[model samples]
Each structure stands twice: as structure tokens, then as C-alpha cells.
Target: MTMINPAGIPHGYNTPIPSEILTADRVETRIGTLEFTDGFPSDDTAAKVFDHLDFLRAVEVFLQCVPAASMEGLRAGLLDIGCDAAHKMVIADRLLDSNPLFLTGNTDTVYALAMLDLHRDGPTVVQIPPGCGPGTVNDAWFRFVTDMGAPGPDRGAGGNYLIVPPEYEGEIPDGYFVSHSPSYTNLLALRGFVVEGKTDVAKAMFEDGVKIYPLSAADARPEMEFSSFSGKEFNTIHANDRTFYNEMADVIRREPIDVIDPETRGLLASIGIRKDRAFAPDEQMCGTLADAAAVGNATARSIVFQTRDKRAYFYEDRKWKTGFVGGDYRWLDGDGRDGRNMDARTMFFYQATLNTPAMALEMVGVGSQYALTERDASGAFLQGSHSYRLTLPSGVPAKDFWSVIVYDPQTRSELQTGQPLPSRSSENNRTELVYNDDGSIDLTFSPEPPSEHRGNWIQTVPSKSWYAILRLYGPLKPWFDKTWKPHDIERI
Candidate 1:
């Protein structure tokens, strides 16, 4: 049976599709039918479209995974995988939307909290002790506010306050503890201290029925306050990864913070810590330290932290760092002296945006694609033979950084040859790159560049199928707008 669309284009696949399968438009037609509907309203129709596009995209992706001549079985295998990928995307997207932190910046903090809940046994209390310094208070506030409930993609319940010196219990001291409801969203309780002195504080905490005494606010610091809370593990998943930092900032900027207490709320406002925006600290050192620790622990064979591209891929031989506290200064030391460190700090505010539960779901998409192409197949490329070329179209849109990376298709990790991987960006300037008259650029890949094109050429050994990833940092308008498309690799 031959099926043709209104435009007379053939739609049927060269390989026979199951009879139960309907065309994307639901119009019954024979083989080769190609109908273009305005849009798909049903999941079935959308699935068909996604499946078709995914198959086409997989063809190009798979070509980079294995040798072209031996791709027949591999191609079939990928087709099955692509179908699954389509379904996964749909399910994942749905999961993301339903998550309380989906479009919010609280994702990573929430995820880390969830991980802690999963790994650690027993009930967790997010304590805001009295007398914590500004930084410690801020850190505790962010963590508690972000993660305090069921610990899933959805915003869990907020913590309940065990406010020291209950409102009815006479004049509160200058130092008091505040607790927020763990069950409600945006719940907070402020404990005040009317009387001064450690003994007085301790008595008030005990007699007034408080679990912990607030540290002296004047002497409070992140390290000092965090130290007091022993035994409970602290997971810093958002601090180190640049991608998470950027995303968190975006989420914070969007969600409005509702502070029921006027004095505390005003205090937050005076410091420029707006409820709808990110923390006031110009540099989010603690979060950065946390991120570095996570990356360090996760680091495997190689860890490449790309600030410009806002992506870090780590491969480690052993279990990497997970929960992080203190030692933040060590990570900063490696960050150059240039104002770059400050810039990284500004980037930290955005971590909440990228580390959400929905973001975890998105990882499903990236991971599946990564795993599929990295598997070793009979048709996989050998050590060296073919040359690959990727051409960046004009007007590539990226703000902070952009780069293309080659991954060992079989390993799915960064290809670690003696030489640094091939990359072109503002960060790694190829002075010898030959720019076209129009100002566009071309990158050539081969084991050996033609003598004249050596400057713009990257080496690729024969027979090894490799995958390419185009990374875009900062605002993604240009890439999202389709004004720019990732370079396509072609064999010479």
C-alpha cells in the first residue's frame, strides 16, 4: 500500500511498520503516506511525531556511534531505543511540571534534601538556632526553606517552628530560636531573646521548651553555627556545579518569598535579600563550596569543570564527594585571582534554578541518549581511520561560553587522549582558525589535519565512533531561537 500526503510526499518507512500503527495524522493511508497535520492534540499523535523525529535524529547520532558500513543492526537497535526515548521525554516533562520546584530555583536544594532523607534514617529537623551570623543564618534559611517536606520533586511540607519563649510566655529574650512549619509552604517562626547571657539563654530554651539554643548572633558564622548541628548529614549538591548554580538563580528570581514576620522580613529587605529574588550575598561561597565538594567526590577518570559553558562532566574511579560542609576556601583557591572568582560567586545565586527535581528528570533524557551512543557495538569505530568535520553556522548565540566536545562513544565519557580534547570557543582561542569572508568558522576533525588546516583541525583516530556535544552557557536564546544550529559532523 502506498500512502501520500496532501503535498504528495511519501510518509511510510522503508522498513515495514506494524499494521496496528496509525499515521501521525490518523488518516488511514497505505505505505509511503506523508500527511502534515497542523498539530497533534492527542498523546498518540504526539508520540508518533516524536518517534519519527527521534528516529531521524538517532540516525545522525548513531552514525557518530558506529561505523557506517556496519550500522544495520545497530540502527535497528537504536530505532527501538529512540521510541522509548520519545515516551520518556513525555513522561519526564509531565513529572517536571508537577514538581513544586519545577520552574523554581529550589530544585537542587530540594533534591539534595531528598537524597539525604533517602540515605539517612530518621526524622530530620531543620533548626535555626539563635545568634547565628548572617551567613550561617542565610545558609540555614535557604536549606530549610528549600527542602523541608516529603523530599521529592514536589515541594515537600515546610518545617514547624519550636519558637523558644512562646508568644504567650512573657517578654522573650534578645536571643530566640525560630522554626517554620514543615508541613506548610513558606512557614516560619521567630524565637526572640529578651534577656542576655548564655545561662539565661539556656534556661529560656529549656524552660520555654526549645530543642536547641541559638548561637550568639554576634559571633555567628557559617562554620561555627553549622558545627553545632552535629550527627545530621548536610548534603551540598547545588554548590559546586555551575549549571545548577545558574538555574537556581533563575528560579529564585521568579519565586516571591513571603515572610510573615515584618521585622525579619524588613531585615531581609534592607540587606537586598528580596523574597522574590536570590540571596543577598554578592558571592555565594557556601553553595560554591558545596558544589565543588559534590564534583570532587563524583570525579572519576577525569573532571573537566567548564565555567564558560556552564557544564561539568566528572568521571571517577571511586565514589566521589556527596555531602559537603566547610573546606569551601580550598575550592576558591583554585579559582583564579581575577575578578573571575567574583563572577563565579554571582553565578552561584542561580544554582537553585538548575538543580530542581524536574532537572533530574531532564537528566533522564540526556543520560539515555548518552548511554545509547556510548555502548560498544560490532560496528563501533576502531582506533583511527575517518576524519570528522563540524561547521558552526553563522550567528551562533551564546553569552558566557560555548564549545563542542568529543566523547568516546563506547565509554560515554570525555575522550581522554594525551592531547586535550578538540574545542573551539572564546575560552580556547584557535589563533590559526581560518575564518570565512562572512566571519563564520569551521572546525575540522582528523587524526592529522591537512598541513594548511592544522590550526582549525582536531584529530580523530580511525574506526572509533565518537559523539559530539555542543555546550552553550548563559542565556540560550540564540540556540533556542534556532538562529543557530549545532555544527554537523561529516566524514571527509
Candidate 2:
């Protein structure tokens, strides 16, 4: 709606036009030169900016859809391992080791994993017995759907859980904990704690008690099948290549159109990743998306490995940090006073899986807490070739127990060393750890075994980079009040 004065005014308008509103003849940007004539962009300028816009949008999509791709990768990996149905699942009967390329999976607990397809099964039912540890169900986007076991409504006295899809209008039967998920594909990951350094009880409990079946088949449910994935070379880590976009496309095609918001859907569409159509981009666009993936992967790596956010640090003086920054499971910045923290979201999903309020909320002695450190004292990254020592002071504030697991920075998985499990838990390594007269425990990290602390030594590969995560199960008040803190790792 242009209202041009038929008779030109003194300065082409009734008032002088501000320079800010007018376009110059030429403008330079990081993308390239943008040329315009009388406020109209040249064809080359329009094409350049449009291409750059698509590239930027593609990068955002990669960052935003990382969770989706990760979940899809889990599903695909499970399917490859013969866990193709809801009744079939994989369990770490012995415990997870370095063989599996999982995202920061701890070696302390027995894990059970399953992929549920509500679209295929209609309504799914999960039944577990008493003594089942913490478990969670995440949507295709890795959003928290519900918790089971300790943090669940049953409070470790496990019962039946009915998970239905978003479009489900079926009757809610009594005596079941119902959860509605917006996506068809959901990941059900369960963990069972090791008691007295043994995984036999937890493994047997899952094998004997856990049952999953479609609710419609309640009268004649299929038999539950469990496969042991301990020491297996399984891959659940998402692709960092251009195939990451394909993983997102698969999830989009599998789930309903309304699974994601319109803004996210439009962003994917901008990169030709719409569910209604094929995700086949032209040759030039393919190369652009590949480059975008490289950039996105590098950004995610930086966010996880070298975060600039101070809130991630657990202590002002130490390198120990928390994975759930801002203490919000939703990844909201300042509790949503600012919108979603995009980098925070990437930081978590890039290196770890699972999203539950139990990991964020202040449950003190009830929930678990984690402190990760990639660097040692003197603000130096932990080198595999160098020797270091870490000391946990007296009165370690864990009600149940604590564990420290070493992980490779590149894979974000358990470090591949001579030891089967690249970790030492209080329960698992009680007989091995040497305690000082003052009741403090000192651990050694080096390529060679230490003479004085041979039992406390964890093998590290030379020329590699690694990190460590100190997990406190049932952390007590001292942990929250900052009265207790793990000492920084010092070079030895």
C-alpha cells in the first residue's frame, strides 16, 4: 500500500528520510557483497543472501534436531541388535563397557533399553516389579515423557504404565499410570543400581520382571525377550555427518506432522527436509548442507567440551561442572525469563542422553548428581600421557554410593583402556581403593600404574584426551549446600 504524493515534496517527502531506512549502493557482509539500486537488491545479492539464509537455517535445524537424530539412532541401533518389537529389549546384564558407542553412559548401573512405537502398537503397557531403579521415557525429540521406578509415581514399587500417542482417544483403563506422548516413537531407558558391587540382582530383576506389550493384547500379551548387550559393539550415537539430516527426516516421517512446532517445521522445510516431500536436495545444496553439518558438529562439540557459560560450573574455583545447566530439565534460560537455551540443549544431548526433572530438580538425598571435569588444576586439559591425582575428602556426601567414570572426549563414551569398565564405584571398587589415614580416597590417572596407588590407578591411553564424571547417587544436603566439594585433579 504505497501512497506516493502526486506532487513531489521539497525532499521527496513531507519529511526528510532517515539514512537508517535507506539502502546504500553496496553493502559488504561475511556472506559476500550485497548490492542494491534504489532500495531494490540485485539478482546476485538476492541469491547470495537467500543461500546464506538457507545455510544458517540448516545449521539451526541441525542443532535443534540433534535430540531427534539421537533418538532415531538409538531406535536404529536397537533394531539392528534384534530389538525390533516392543516385547524385545536389550539389557546390560553385566554392565556397559567401552565397546558400545553410547553418549556418556555410565558403567555403574545395569541398563535396559527399548523403543516403543505407539503408532504401530496403538497403546503400550510397561510393567516392572518392585526394586526397579530409576527409569525414563523420552519422546522422539528426547523430551521427557515420564519417569519410572524411584522418581516415578510408584516410588520404586514398580507397577504398570500405559503410554499412548497424542491422537489416541481410547478409554483410560483403571490401575495404570497413563502417559500421553506427542510422538509415535519413544525411548524407554531404565537403570538398575549395583548393590554390593554386583550386577546379578539388577540384571535378573529386569530379566524376570520387566514386561512390555501393547495394551490391546492385554489378554494375550507376548512373552518378553531380553538380549544382553554387555561388551557389545553397538552404536547409539547420532551421526555428525550429513546423514544427521536423514535421521531427522526419518523421525519426522515416522511421527505425526504436529509433533514439532510450526517454527521448527518451517526451519526444516527451509532446508528441504519436509516430511510431506522427499529430503533430496540439489547437488549444490547437498554440499552446502554437508558444510552446515560440519559447522553444526563443531559448534556442538564446543558447547559440550568447552562451554563458555559460567552456570555450567559447579564451583567457582574448580573445573567440576554440571551437565544440567540452569538446573532446568526444560533447558530454559533463567527459568524461561529468557526463552529456551539452545546451546544448553545442544550441550546436553551432544554428550549425554536422558532428560528428567530428577536430574535437575533439587531432590537432595533422593536423586543423583553429576560433576564432570575435563581439565585438571592449573586450568590445563587432562592429557592422557600425563599423570594426575584426584582426592575425595572425608565425609563424601552420598547416601547410597558414588562412582567416577572416565570417558573419551571424541566418542563421549567410556574410555577404551585395558580395564573392561573404565570406572571405579565405591560399591564396585571398595576392595581395590586405598584409603588414607585421614579417611580420604586418592585416585590415580596415568598411562602406567603407580607404585603407591596401584589399586586406585585407572589406565589412560597415551596421546588421547579424556574426561571424568563423578556421580553421586542419593546425594545428601552437603552436596547442595556446598559444604562438600570434590578436590580438583592435580598433576602428579
Tell me, by TM-score, which candidate is best.
2
Per-model C-alpha lDDT, please? Answer: 0.31, 0.89
Estimate, for each residue in 77-111, the C-alpha lDDT of model 2 and write its tens digit: 88889888999989998899899888899888899
Give the backbone clash total of model 2: 0
Flag regions of model 2 displaced more than 4 Å: 1-14
Q: Estimate the overall C-alpha local distance difference test score of candidate 2.
A: 0.89
Q: Give the number of colliding residue pairs in candidate 1.
A: 71
Worst 10 residues of 1 by lDDT: 105-114
Q: Per-prediction TM-score, please? A: 0.30, 0.96
lDDT (Cα, 0-100) at 472 in candidate 2: 92
Tens digits of per-residue lDDT for model 1 on 192-262?
Answer: 22122112342233223222212222234222110111112222222223333333333223333331245
